[model samples]
Target: MKLTLIFLIMISFLSGCNKSENDEKPEKKELELKSKEVLEATDRFGWELLQAVNKEADPGQNVVISSLSVAQALGMTTNGAANETLSQMLDVMDFGEVSEMNEAFHNIREVLQTADPKVQVDIANSVWYRQGMPAKESFGEALEEDYDAAFREVDFSKKQEAKDLINGWVNDKTKGKIPSIVDEISAGQYMFLINAVYFLGKWQYEFDKSATKDEDFTLSDGSTMQVPMMNQETDLDFYSGEDCQAVKLPYGDGSFYMVIALPANGIELDEFINSLDTNKWSTITDNMHERGLALFMPRFEVECKFKLNQTLIDMGMELPFSEFGADFSNMTEAQVFIDEVMHKTYIKADEEGTEAAAVTSVSVVVTSVGGGGPMPFRIDRPFFFAIAEEESDAILFSGKIENPKQ
Candidate 1:
């Protein structure tokens, strides 16, 4: 008999400007930097994951994923991994060593959750195991102490009850943006590791709704569609590269930002995306300077869902999903392997601001796995965007916008 372990991750971001005259921005303390390497590794992993998912998506389909959410879930799961399975997971995530990974993640969560007083960021983790399942003491301690996860015991025999308990937590964390993630729980599934992230921030500079008007937006195939284009004029951090032009839209005192990159005329979106790498990304971001600009962007909404089992495998993380080759002795005495990795996300951006949410679940019976800016920046065509923090440069959410109507 084989037991399964399931992991679920959910992340959400909500943005809008509702500042009153009496509202004064509070002075926020500087976030101490301790995990520069972990930040870099996670950002690199984010780019790679986005590229991989893009390769598998149909043309013109918008894609979004929360890299931080996925990393946190996987980081918790890695506590139980051993031998080749452990090494493979670490390598795929670009985590060079395990010594400080947990500490780094904990620090990251603390900083991100409290980065900006005006912004509301919440990160929560929990573990639910079958009533009789014997999870190692060390593993539980690592989750509770390092990851700050809440532990519970559920009877898997009552599948509906189990589903409600897990899904209820996901819904609560996301503030109902994501109502549920668990549709069913099989008898073989013995445990679940879940991570949920929620973010809500008002724009530092809000767009006037009255200025929004329908405008022509060019499609990838030389076609055009009319979209509700939000217009604004202000000083913004901008970048002009050989292949693309970019802009940064700060949220709540500039600790977090949304950066948008539009491909230059003659360059296809796919072509530019394929060319993106860590070095190129650094160059683009590092070169940005404040410039007075006119900006036009569409009010768009995007939702994406993906099963990342094959994607992770293609990225060289294989053994954890292999039934016979897998080893998770550190987690439990039971012999188990991953079953699926489910991810879902939703984002809505309007004149007031943007709201986005994501959920990723990995079942090890189960196996699973798992932004933006601006400019005169007329986003009149398909472009890439990311939501990231200034201190850590940690990418919380990222995706491409092909059509606002969809």
Candidate 2:
């Protein structure tokens, strides 16, 4: 018998913005920068998540995560989280209060949406639920107003049709890079909170395609494999720190870029990762200087599809996932708890530039809960990566490419 996996999907896209715009006055920009607390909190949250997920990553496997996407989805869900469940979720995300957290997300999203006219950056949020299981007005309004999420009701019992509708939205938003994010609507799943981000941009300094060649890449197991490697030499922001060497490769107008962190010689990748925090990352980025360097990066495409339940738990977000411990009463009158947090990502880095897409689904099963840097001087061995916006330093996506061939 053919198995049909059922699940709820929360569809999100990166090309848009939350309807509620944040203060964008010049004075406000200065204030936002001076008050580094928001940046610190967001970076701290991303770092903690990277470490937690990295610990669970398979040895020598490629791991990619859109922390911004995941955080946005959970932050929207947090609007419905209350009391201890809300407190635990906030603590894990490093936010002092819910109001502060919402504003931070708002500001970050606003900056990203308006960052560039050449680069396609869209962010979208939505709520999908089964018919007759309508979300509470208050909860719905909070998501619709604050998060700028669209809501839709469907008969999830028609799993195939529902899957198509949900996946089609994802495909359209990501330009078909991520064709589908959900396979089936599993029983007991009542609602989903989805956040999707899609980005396509050309490098400020494109590499010479004729110069691309298959080169040897040393794997973690001390073995080598030949991969199509792209080479370039240019003036870019570079940093050499005690733990790692870093480089920033800008996309389009330079408001967005890729930061690669290569661990210093003799330092293990895991050790370098564990040593990262918001403060350290801020210092590293601030200290980078314009310098010329010869860079060789692999021309590769990779994807990761996994459930983040265990990872979130390990990061101290247990209450939201616990059926008994969860308290998402604001989302609906019915008792609900988070059953799973599903994430999917597609990324490609070639001679021209980089394109990436991510979709995160936070499933509320009648109970549920929710929810880095470079030194690249060469990424031949395992190295950490983060695609971010410069002005706000908002991390859009991050991961370690253990083996591009994977």
Candidate 3:
């Protein structure tokens, strides 16, 4: 009952995902430090995810890697790196003392610790069904007012107090990186999960806008589109040989970078992604050198939302949301457990740093990257991407591009 009271209190101040764009911006590597705890937590999670991608992905598109790190999330000028930390954590239903998973939960709380107490309560967030279902019933009267319905009522004309209060708080923290906190919610949702993000960044060397060109981009399906590609010839960490096709673009001070792994011709994209290993990731990072190279980036931003219930089931970690659940007895007794889990994330970028965050929740119901390789993978078309921090290579966001339409 005490645990229920605490969680229910959190659910009141919840904020659902305000999905944003994937707009790309110009940024260069620079020197920025991160909390050591955040670094270890992020990398360990990223490593675990690499292990999963190495096993489960399809032949052509099996392993996709991308990230947004704490540094990048908190940055003002450069994207953190390919973001992968959160995606892996979402797939796992139980932590089971695994160092990475444990560290991950710790890092999340660490970030939360920095937030204002009112901010935490105002979000009224948690993972569970809210309609007095068997799960939400634990809270008695504390758990009323569905966050989803509240989101629906937030019209530009007449906004709900809950939504406005939370969004304003997030905007202030992120320096406007996250302008809107609640995009949409439903009456049937069991839990109201909210994640706030903040970021600021600048390019080491600003792009000469005059050099931007409307170039042809060959997508995976052999289709082509005209995109404004930011092209620059600079000294970069480049590697090319029989085993790989790749390059690393540094932002600002050379402490962080964006690495692209291109698949070799004739090899299936999914196969290359699925066959990924830590060494392959290592090679991309290890072989990187400061050399003269050409950089081409399309000016584009994409925002998407997806129901990932099926995707999580496909992964190996499947115990908590089920009748066989995570043991949260430490929080309270009375056989309390998670019911359902949901996750929502958003990212946006351009000539500079990336601003992104992921939010996930588990109820009486439930809840829950990248790189490289031999024969060189060319991501000229649809491919996996990540945003990572340098020291720990903490990935904050991760996703696949099988059919962006969905």
Candidate 4:
């Protein structure tokens, strides 16, 4: 008989934009071979994850998520998986091999953290296990060496103390943008693998605060509400697609950007989102060109929380969550499986730029779980947006704003 080990993993990501002046742009560097491959793979995975989550969301509801955070946390956990569990995770994430994935993630983290001196990007990882639980030495070593993860052995029986330790790290890493992720620790839960990312950068071109004014924002329901819309007329990387108008707003030193896409007048936000795929996304992003134009977007904030177990199962990653069939023996001597995945996100976009944060927590009782365009480009209606790195085009955060006020 296999002894079941319950594991919980929490992944959190945070990004902030403040007003600043940095006239110099960072020099573009060529991506290494492994970095390039992983970027493409993760980008594909990110899109698929976004579409899946959107499908599960309520009609007209807002959604924001950090694909990088989810990938990092799961990537660390993948080190412990074997057999079909490993294969399914690799297939779902679009990764080629384990060694390649590990090396690539390490390289990408290095590149992203030092991408621009003007921008601040921090990535952190941790491993927490029950005080006496036996875990594979190789598993912990890989996480520490490849992902720079910090390890702590805690008394799981002391639930409140363990919870505080984990949540405190999250709060500190996110600069208090997200106060806590683990609400309570269950009895069967033994270990947690976590990843936290924090990013802060200013816009290359800040919107004038004086120009922001009350404007009508059209909701998905066709109702309209007054919102503080920021207006700007400047040169920006713009794309005119058959389905939507898109623009890329660069952040500090041009190493990062926020891409916003507004579906054509008659198209619904959901319809446009459903039509998006990796192929279309690449083509649209590749075609963007700098152009001078009038731009209007509301200064708004959105917070979203979701339980993503069924979503991942629907996406063809079911074995790891299974109680009987799950194989995480590579991680520990005991049989373990995932239990739940919880994701929460917050974003605020204004004239200064955009500030966003997300936390994706996977609880393994062992179970678990688990963009646009432009125009003179008025975003008066519901639209999609993403924060990404310019070099690899890796999406750090992505979401839709149905109504900014909500």
Candidate 5:
């Protein structure tokens, strides 16, 4: 199937602060579209987030974005004929020059293969590769798995089995740090179609046992709760906003960042969440000027699973995957339509904190750390977080921490 991530340049104004925005369209709008479908997938949730997965902020910058699609990728190849929705999506995917990178492609294959002797990955995008032929060959070889229907079309009706398969792959890929994949899937017309899954996580310098302690969590809507808070008193880039305050905690060798959001008092939980917008996100990102600040957050983790069917319906994207309105003929012999799309994610943070996992279909990878902080923002009630590349502002991971110890 085809996948797209179109991160268009969007602009908005925060409530109080009229943040200056860069509306000047980039001279080079070199965006690849099939990926756009994948990027807009998050429109279902205002608070939901998907960002870039850049290497650390140190010297040699490396990036890794992993995506597992279970739909059109297999829809057009298998099934009564793979799903056309996914097939048409992939029609324009550019493989670029990655087909040339033999060594690098081999290494990628080794990593994925060494990781899963059972499951195989197939990459078919016409995307460009900058590292010349070696890198191209690496990608090509890494994606050289023929269709056998094992990891091909997913049996959505067999939900548990579906979860098991994806969880297995994600668990292996994340080195057990995260398990962000479901076992099965189902499309109305087809009992078994394709699916896409992804998982990513990083340890920002393992938390010291002595640093965690019980603390108070003040949520919006005037509610206060007690929760374990992770205390790491280090200098960092901090923002104290009128609507909501935020703290950027560096993570892993400095490639990505973990940004925590604590809403202002008197703000209702639903109200605050409802108020979420690109402008709010933009405000937080633009205010990311590195500043010396201390930080502390409740040591808590949460596991949340959401059936995004209705959520997607609520978003403006009800056109492609709708029951009566979907148009996916390019993928299969049948008029393939999107039956439903589901999502489940989990995260835990405590004294020896911050452990989380999620399951979904898409691409992204991030782990950054090259800054400072000692910020204290308990997330007892509800707060937002994101895994992002500090340099480019591309967010790879984003979620809300409602219950700290849950």
Candidate 6:
């Protein structure tokens, strides 16, 4: 099995939105890439969100998440929002306007989906609503054309079947890596919008598994555990920061790479994570240059699951989840609000390559907050990692490994 990680975010909104887009598919048009300003904004949003959700991590526990999945799902949710609800969501997401963010998301997806032939990056979006829910025409049109999302009518009252069908779609999109995203559909959840991204890539320079050996991985509390260590020494883009060290490991054609950042000894991982910003991130990756250094990393896996309603609220997106204060009139004529947002991610890294997937589900009834250098980069303790596209600088998946043994 290749080093693989899967991330899933399930957002459950309480209110339902628009109807099916017309059956006929429109002629394809070449989409433009996101502007530098918007792309930078998107990157900043990811980092800020990383800080927000990092608050939920437990001491000495691993946490990994997909910022792309969260942004895509919430961006889709913004389409049907209006008034204060829309404003707050946009502010929290750091998006200027719904139209611009929609385009940015489309462009980013387009670039990533077609980045390289050797690497497989697929992003799929869909909407499933209870049969007879009267979602608005404008809302449906936006979702169809702007987001390129498929629409399905389901009997949400038949909770079990509805849950299974939605979960099956996510499983299929993630290549069966994520079998199910929804275990239960609550009483008032009239609709669900889901986005899934699956990525598979081979290391530009593969590690020799034959040289792998068990080594000691130190924990934050000074405890240690034995883990399979993979060793490689090549001229890789490396950077050293005031508080951390980082390196970029290219994948496939080098359009995409995994950047890992390890905190300097004596710097707490949480302290470093809290202080990270776009400037700090840029300072590290921008200063990176090809340097020959010994790289020793543990081969490990991480699975993180979270309910993001509170995290988002903490990030200044409180109105959407407020059952009484939300305004989703653009989606439906009735009173509606978001309820909850759920996220789950899984990742595994070894010698050959890396494979990862993420799913973001938004239920209308309710919800949803929601990188590095290299140096001798011995990631013996807690550290962070991000997989991103070089051109757009869009972060696809990111996480912190506190203790891989768990």
TM-scores for every predicted model: 0.89, 0.87, 0.57, 0.89, 0.56, 0.88
- Residue 84 lDDT in candidate 1: 92
RMSD of 6: 9.2
lDDT of 2 at 34: 25
Comparing 2 and 5 by TM-score, which wins? 2
Report the C-alpha displacement of residue 329, candidate 3, in angstroms: 3.5
| C-alpha lDDT of candidate 2 relative to the true structure | 0.79
Each candidate: how many clashes? 34, 36, 103, 21, 103, 32
Give each model's whole-structure lDDT.
0.80, 0.79, 0.40, 0.80, 0.40, 0.78
lDDT tens digits, residue span 97-141, model 3: 233332343334333322222121112232222332232232222
- Please give the ranking of all candidate structures by lDDT, highest first, separated by commas: 1, 4, 2, 6, 3, 5
> Model 2: per-residue lDDT, tens digit, 155-239?
8888888889888888887889889887768777788888899989899999999999998888888899999988887788988
Candidate 2 segments whose C-alpha is farther than 4 A from its true place: 1-39, 367-377
- Best-fitting candidate, scored by lDDT: 1
Candidate 5 residues 1-406, lDDT tens each? Answer: 1121112322222233454433322222222342333222322222322211111111211111122222223222221212343233333222112222222222222232222212222222111111111222322233333221232334445667655765566565444545644333332324222232332334454456676677777543356777766555545666778878887765544545577777787764444545655567778767866665445666654544444444433433344454444443322223444444444444554443244343344211111110444334444556767655443333444645545544
- Model 6 per-residue lDDT tens digits across residues 314-341: 8899988887788888887666677767
Q: Identify the runs in model 4 with alpha carbons over 4 angstroms from their true place.
A: 1-30, 366-375
lDDT of 1 by residue, 269-340 (tens): 888887787798888889999988889999998778888889989999899889778888888888887777
Question: What does candidate 2 score in Cα RMSD to the true structure?
Answer: 8.3
Q: How many backbone clashes does candidate 1 have?
A: 34
Any runs in candidate 6 off by more than 4 Å, and if so which? 1-35, 366-376
lDDT of 1 at 344: 74
Q: Identify the runs in model 3 with alpha carbons over 4 angstroms from their true place.
A: 1-199, 241-243, 323-327, 332-340, 361-380, 399-406
